[model samples]
Target: MSLTQEQKDAFKAIFIETVTNFAQQVGQATEKVFLQILPLTVVAGTEYLKSYEEDLKTKLEDCKTKSQKIIGALSTVKEPEKVEKTGDKHLPLGELLGKRVQRGEDWKWDDQDGGIGSFGKVVGVKGNGWVKVQWESSRNENRYRWGVDKAYDVKVVEIVDDLGDIPPLEEQIKKPTSWVIGKSVVRGRDWKWKDQDGGEGQIGEVIDVCDEGWVEVKWKNGTVCQYRWGGENAFDLKVVPKPKE
Candidate 1:
């Protein structure tokens, strides 16, 4: 199921919060370790406890990796400007979103050669020139990353999106294209639920729980559903279409 914007935003927010908290906790834990009085001892003691610590570190690394993935997935637009420009000053998001996005193309106009440079497929494109074309970075890899090089300036040219790498706007967002609902209730931070059908259910994890009567959920099965949060838990039946494979 495609995720709703509310659900997506909530999820992104949680992941960001978790990553931030983990970093802080790790810093504090490291500081504590340094403050230890192991002046003349080995690096560790209680082999079992040492093993546990190792496992904890491994888990922490895994969480960090997952968090990184979340960041990479969610950060697609540039940070929002105070106001969207109506004219040629800048393109409103509606003009850019769902626009023809190619997978292996590039455009390099305003060049030293004084010509338009559009090449390959889009790979990815933001507004008119802001894009990530099918070009490889100095460091080549078979993986996608949240390119932070979109905020840069090049000589003889106006600007560049951090070397053709950019993240989504921290403010402006794409509307959700899909969702779900049914005779079950989801609640709490985890947004878990007990389906009245005598089955365990969850809206997935809580996306943004808005002050409004809406709670978004992106379920484990990759379904995004939102419910008006009020009254009784179970409401009319709502079904969601399976996402295209």
Candidate 2:
């Protein structure tokens, strides 16, 4: 006779409970035997007890294996039911919208070449998990779709009060002929000095400017190097105006 759904469920539950209880009782019995043998410590008593314990442990492991097999068998006894959705229903995009993000919030792209450390700002978040961000290094705005299109590629790192106060990359890299020795400057994104590894946003002072336009900069860390002052490397160095003392 075929059993009803409720009857089948009750039978399966009872079977699992019974087997689990039996396994627990066997485990407890094994532990009791080990405890009872703990007191004997004569010459050969130790060796004998150790051998018996090993044998007992092997039996317990076999029991555990059998219990696991019983549980595995239960899976074949019943098939899982699948629920079908009828309407044009969709899961809500929660926590992916403005909740965790806001305008002018700094972010870093989680990509190769250490984009994770590169700073950017959120321009806006479109409804369906799309967020527009303006990168600090490139100064370019790009749209990223969260969850679906690796929106997690970029993570919000900081929030600024005013983005407008930040100067453009072009203006920051402009070479001023009036720059004199001992003037402070910052390493721009285009700055790629070998051996020194001068990272982006590193502040330094101009130690000397050669006739060929190669400027020797003394970084805040005391490391000095002569970096090229023209082409791609030219924009790599930015002149920083000294703050009022």
Q: Give me the candidate number with maximum TM-score.
A: 2
- What pairs collide in candidate 2? 191-236
* Tens digit of per-residue lDDT, candidate 2, span 1-245: 89999999998887556656755777755445445434633646878989999999999999999999998975554322222334211112322221222222123434421253565544444454555555555645566544433224454433333222435557544533213234456765566564363565667765544444566677767797776666434655665554444
lDDT of each: 0.36, 0.51
**What is the per-residue lDDT of model 1 for residues 89-208, given as tens digits with 9 covering 90 to 100?**
233322221122212112233332222332221122233234332222221111111122332111111222221232232211121211111112234322334452233433233333
Q: Candidate 2 local accuracy as lDDT?
A: 0.51
Model 1 TM-score, 2 decimals: 0.20
Report the C-alpha displacement of residue 221, candidate 1, in angstroms.
21
Give the per-residue Cα lDDT of candidate 1 at 234.
31
TM-score list, all predictions: 0.20, 0.26
